[model samples]
Target: MSEIGITCTGAAVVNAIFNATGRRVRDLPITLHKLL
Candidate 1:
């Protein structure tokens, strides 16, 4: 889903992804995060 884009629902977006998968975004890679 992130590959497409984040939804307008903020945390709900992460929650949806987490529900579908099994991982939580504890942290992002520094370089990738800094770019965003």
Candidate 2:
């Protein structure tokens, strides 16, 4: 049960990281694309 809890917490952290990285990446290209 403790291991499962740790695994779930790790998964949540990874998901949050992915979401933040994705948001930053998605925002970056629009201005460059517009300029180009």
The TM-score values for the models, in the order shown, are 0.43, 0.44
**Could you give me the TM-score of model 2 versus the true structure?**
0.44
1-36, model 1: which lDDT tens digit per residue?
774455445566556656866656544332434333
Total backbone collisions, model 1: 0
Cα misplacement distance, residue 23 of candidate 1 (Å): 0.8
Which residue runs of candidate 1 sit more than 4 Å off their true CA positions?
A: 1-8, 27-36
Q: Name every residue pair that clashes in candidate 1.
A: none
Root-mean-square deviation of Cα positions for candidate 1 versus the true structure, in angstroms: 8.8
Query: How many residue pairs clash in each candidate at the backbone level?
Result: 0, 0
lDDT of 2 at 16: 64
Best candidate (score: lDDT): 1
Question: Please, what is the whole-model Cα lDDT of each candidate in the order they appear?
Answer: 0.52, 0.50
